[model samples]
Target: MNCLLFTWRKGDGKLKIHEVRKQLTTPLGAPAYPWGPYNFRNREYLNILYRTDMEALRRVVPEPLAIDEPLVKFEVMYMPDAPGLGAYTEAGQVIPVSFNGEKGEYLHAMYVDNHPAIAVGREVSAYPKKLGAPRLYIDSDTLVGTLDYGSLRVATATMGYKHQPMDLALARQELSQPTFMLKIVPNTDGSQKVCQLMRTQINNPTIHGAWTAPARLQLFAHALAPMADLPVLEVISASHIITDLTLSKPDVIYDYLAEH
Candidate 1:
């Protein structure tokens, strides 16, 4: 069966433009496809889990959702190849949040090199995705990543690779949990078009390797995007996981514009 993307009546005529869906999953009937023709082989992740000030955390986190433990996860992923979207690198910040008593990870800021991935991520899950130059590489025993906004370096993270083996079961469980994000779009007239809370879960993720070590995270102030607002207080854990994760369906939790 074919799916319809969008339709608009032109002038007084009934001529309409319709596009067929290509990707496996889409929003209800939206012409857009599900993110990822996702298959990752030896995908590398260098992550740092750290504690931050409660005040700093509160400022960055949106209302209605409360911070769980003032913790933040900064991760760098090197995807040599991915389905649909080609090779790309990504770095981002995630906060431990609880909404309506349900615990989930909230995506704070995500930067990637590919435009297609950014577009699809925003459309599908309301992910706060931005286009930037991000690189993840291994140098000797250290795994490092940097996010660059034009010429300015905004974030950096480093970790010791495979320093210690992590419990595969616990690591898998943590990676498989649900994640929340804010999906916001503006109308042409400069008004809020869509603002909603989005929830998504990982699908059939296979963990091939998992390692842990002490890590470091740094965020610098940017004139455009201020990631430094979420200051780091203490480094909790650093982990590296090689796995393949499928981006699953997204569910909208709350619509801010809905009239009760």
Candidate 2:
């Protein structure tokens, strides 16, 4: 058929294949986000460290990573300006874990209000990022952070405004720890294509300011957003930090399906 021949001719484009091969991200011509390393200028964070149930912590953390303690960090972050991804608000829960005797934090659950952030986080790294409503701002005398999923508030955190200044050296040391994540990509036939533990370490970031404050956090039960699954037992410590940092691309450390 002439129509069939025309369609085949239209479909047979040689340059597009070469162009796609040379590209960095998804889509043939248009990418959702630009290539990394994404730089954040004056990134602010409201980090709330709390104690949680040890048994609950073991359920989500995968193998090879030993739970350092019965602890979880609830963080709400606001980025003023990010190149290629623009500014976005993010909030999530991370668990402190140890891999081969080295202390690190595991990427558990992250929610961002920006599409580019959600795409880049999952596509590039194994970051468990989803699209949700997260806000980080300051009220009259308290710093407030909240996460909402479909009109239901999943987590809320409040902190006193900058009570004591945190030492910059100690802050940098804490931030430089390696972050581990489970990267799982499925194959076309629904079988497992890729399952590995990925790691990334942030190093030599310029810290602008850091502070510790009395704070409180509450996690509500949500079917989709399972921040309450860990069940915050007690608020241990809280910190509000502002810094300029760079997000590093992850490297595969352990392949779950590798030969024994």
Candidate 3:
């Protein structure tokens, strides 16, 4: 009989059989960072809330998350110094919802530059993240965000930067609310491996600056990230803010795969 040995590779070195690998995350293994300083600084965000089709909105929202309004928030964020995820730009669509009698936001789709952010976001926070090029930058006097899926541009948003100052206390209170997501991981047999509604909040967020302004949003119909599904009915509100926050741990609110 012959015995074989297996080893894993690390940065500039190799791991011996006896040495245990790091536990970063459960789903993807050692690469995912479970805990972090998980902090963000000078994180600039542009949020555009627009009214969408009520019937179209109902199709995507999961159970227990009732539509509070027919509004969806399209956000573009620039995280210059995110402790764990590093510097990255994120763009996503979050819908206004009510869960368990409390009003909150629900993540529908997200796109980011970094791979680690995508993996950990999906695994821990139940964020529906996909890899793409999303950027937030200042073009002339306007704050802009654009998302590109491959060579195709999916969405673009532009707003007047700090055109109107909002009350700081009011902004702080709005930033403290928890956000929800529907997490579904399928099994090899096409059944659900894990299905649940998750709740995660940005803890102790300090809004250093906030401003409200007129904004415009353009969403294209792409099969990969169909942002056009919502179909904007009216532009409700738009705002830009700079904040420092902590990405806190998540709590399971509802289990879809659980037995009755």
Q: Top model by lDDT, which number? A: 2
> lDDT tens string, model 1, 1-260?
23343455557464344332333444446534444545766677887888888898888788678887989988788888677777888888889898999888989999888876787788755878888888988879988888898889998888886789999887787787679889888999889999998888876688998988867888899976577787877899888888877667789888888975
lDDT of 3 by residue, 1-260 (tens): 23354645556376454544444555534566547657889888888989999999999998879997789999988899887678998898999899879998999999999877888888766889999899998899998989998889999999997899989886776677679988888999999999999998876778889999889999999999899998877888888889998788889999987875
Winner on lDDT between 2 and 3 is: 2
Better of 1 and 3 by TM-score: 3
Error of 2 at 203 (Å): 0.8
RMSD after CA superposition, every candidate: 5.4, 3.4, 4.4
**Clashes found in each candidate (C-alpha, N, C closer than 3 A):** 0, 0, 0
Off by over 4 Å in 3: 1-22, 25-34
- Name the candidate that leads on TM-score: 2
All candidates' lDDT scores?
Answer: 0.80, 0.90, 0.85
The residue pairs in collision within model 2 are: none
Q: Which wins on TM-score, candidate 2 or candidate 3?
A: 2
- Residues 12-87, candidate 2: write the lDDT tens digits: 6555544556887877578999888899999998999999999999999999999978999999999999999999
TM-score of 2: 0.93
